[model samples]
Target: MADIEPYENALDAIPGAHPYPRTSRYHDAEIGIHRQADGTEVRYAKRRLLPPIEDRTGDDTQSHTVRTGERPDLLGRRYFGDPGQWWQIADANPVLDPRELTDEPGREIDVPLAGHFPRSPQGDRRG
Candidate 1:
């Protein structure tokens, strides 16, 4: 005779199962960040005003060109002191492309004010 054990049906029936595999606070400078269920967007909090970027363009080769449009990763290394943190800078500026960070002669994107860039519904800062 062979011994057999009963089979478990639901996932909850299994022992040692944790509910949340990951936890996040979602702390963004922008307040309008929230989740969408069906087709409508719901605001979680009031939008926070971001500091405007100071126009620091000097009398050089380029004029009327946006400076915030520069590569984010490089700016991250320079500003945040972390190259990996580039996405943070990029997220704050949706007009710029992430891949273009390494592109020579980077494209001119509208410089975001020093203030926090609006986060997308998907949580990605990319335009």
Candidate 2:
């Protein structure tokens, strides 16, 4: 298993992005390192490409309509009882960018059923 040192570094370099799940395959991915003319090094992780939403199973019971000013994390907390599981809602929906999933009011989003998320090594919940 790969450690999260590099991923943590990459998260520190990015703004407005949360840390990758500890059990996620991308958690161990190599971040690009570039050296500036002044000899400063910058570390960054490549944009993570999510699998197609078609790959996810549909559950009519978990479907939700985008309300005004709602976000994925809020929905995750409402449906799954965990705000950190926002990615499950993001992944189950067609939008690649989570922000787009809730960007417009009245848009419908598909939320994955409970237990649809990957489990951490310690059996903790993750997104």
Candidate 3:
């Protein structure tokens, strides 16, 4: 899969969630598996929900003007020192799709304060 590292990182950061199939379209989704009447297994997946916009707003929040060729992971690395934390920026914005959120140039996005997110484990922060 193309650009799967961000998804893997996000999934790793979520606590106590079921492990999703890496090859599934729902690889980035939160999922539950269930057994059907005879012996069939079904997987139900939902896009992970974000916290309310109000919850992400704060005095320390900062804004970034989208520049050409910028992406969430790139922005995360630039601002937070960890590219894997892209979801933090995605969750703070209003768009349901993070790709759309970062696709345009000149768009403005709110960046949550660094303290609002969990710090990366000492060894995990890497380019």
lDDT of each: 0.40, 0.63, 0.65
The TM-scores of all predictions, comma-separated, are: 0.29, 0.50, 0.55
Which numbered prediction scores highest in lDDT against the true structure?
A: 3
TM value for model 1: 0.29
Model 1 residue 38 lDDT score: 75
**Model 3 C-alpha lDDT per residue in residues 13-93, reported as the tens digit of each score:** 677443543332234554567899988988776455445565444574788899899998898788777777677787677
Instruction: Compare the candidates by TM-score and give the number of the best one.
Output: 3
Q: Which clashing pairs does model 3 show?
A: none
| Models ranked on TM-score | 3, 2, 1
Evaluate residue 87 in candidate 1 and report its C-alpha lDDT on the 0 to 100 scale.
58
lDDT tens digits, residue span 1-127, model 2: 2433576556656764644544343553445789999999988865555545554555433667899989877887888677776876776666758888889999877776665543323333223
Tell me model 2's lDDT, rounded to 2 decimals: 0.63
Q: lDDT tens digits, residues 1-127, model 1?
A: 0222233223335553322111111333234656677757765644433323342232211221325545555665665465655555444333356765435453443323332334434443212
